[model samples]
Target: MPAFVGAIKINDISGSAVVNIGDVFHIEPRSQTKTFAGAGSFNTGNYLRVKNGYSVTHTVDADNVDNSNIGNT
Candidate 1:
C-alpha cells in the first residue's frame, strides 16, 4: 500500500538513521562499526605517584562480511 505524508518539520538525522516515504518494495545497505582505545589518569604539579591498568579491545567475528557482494536482481 501507499501513504500520504503531511507537512514535514525539519530537524536532524543521526549518523544512523533511515527515512522512508510512500510505498517501497525493500530497503538495503546498512553498516555499523565501533572502536575504542585505552583510558588512564595522571596528574602533575609537584609530585604524584600512581599505578593504573586500563585496557580496551575490539574483535571481529568470523561470520562478519567484508569485501563481499550481496542481494540479487
Candidate 2:
C-alpha cells in the first residue's frame, strides 16, 4: 500500500480568496483520455498533496474549491 500523507478540512460558506503555502487540497480529475493501451479512462482517484512551496499565489473561484484532510502521517 502507498503511504498516506496528510489531510485538511475547510468550511467556507462564502467569499473568494487566494491560496497560500501550507494549504492542503484534494485534487481530482474530471475527465481523462487514454493515450496508450491498457490505460483506463474515466477513472477517478483522490490524491492529497500539501503546498510545501509555490512560486506564485494561486487564486480560485467558489466553484474550484474544496476541503482538505490534514495531520495524517
Candidate 3:
C-alpha cells in the first residue's frame, strides 16, 4: 500500500480488493495532508527515494458497472 498522507476509506465488499499505483479510486479525504509518494517510493524529510515497482488492481465489479458506492447502501 502506498503511503497515504491522510486517512483513506477502502471499501472492499467482496473481501478481495487490490489497489495499485496509477489506478484511481474514490477517496474521501479526512485531513489536509492528502499527498502520496509514487509507486515503490517514499519521502523522508524532504528527500524522496524509489525502490521497486509494486502495483495491482481489484475487481470492484465483475460486470464493470459504476459501483463506486457498493457498500454504502
Candidate 4:
C-alpha cells in the first residue's frame, strides 16, 4: 500500500522507522564509466614503463573487470 511517500510522518511506528510505502523500484542503477587520454593503459599490470631515465621500475596490478559487471535492469 505504498506509492510515493514524502513527508507526512506518523509516530508510534517503532524500531528502525522505515516507511517506504512500496512501489519505488529503480533497480539496475549501476554506472561505471572510465575515459582516459594520453598515457595508454587502463586497469593494468606489468607496466614497467620508463621514459628518459637511467632507472629501473616494476609495476603490476591486474584485474581488469574479470567478470560479472552486474545484470538485470
Q: Pick the candidate with the highest lDDT.
A: 1
Tens-digit lDDT track of model 3 for 37-68: 45544545656555666665442445644325
Q: Score candidate 2 by TM-score against the native.
A: 0.18
For candidate 4, give the lDDT: 0.50
TM-score of each: 0.35, 0.18, 0.19, 0.24
**RMSD of model 4, in Å?**
16.2
The superposed Cα distance between candidate 3 and the true structure at residue 44, in angstroms, equals 9.1
Q: Where is model 1 more than 4 Å wrong at Cα?
A: 34-73
Q: Which ten residues in a row have the lowest lDDT in candidate 1?
A: 34-43
Q: Write the per-residue lDDT of candidate 4 for residues 28-59, one digit (tens) a residue.
A: 42344444333333345676663543434344
lDDT of 2 by residue, 1-73 (tens): 3445477566663333343345446544333332332223335678844344334433434563254434422
Question: Which 10 successive residues of model 3 have the least lDDT summed?
Answer: 28-37
**Better TM-score candidate (1, 4):** 1
Measured with C-alpha atoms, the lDDT of residue 20 in candidate 4 is 54
Supply candidate 4's per-residue lDDT for 15. 50
lDDT of 3: 0.46
Per TM-score, the best of the predicted structures is 1
Residue-level lDDT for 53 in candidate 2 = 38
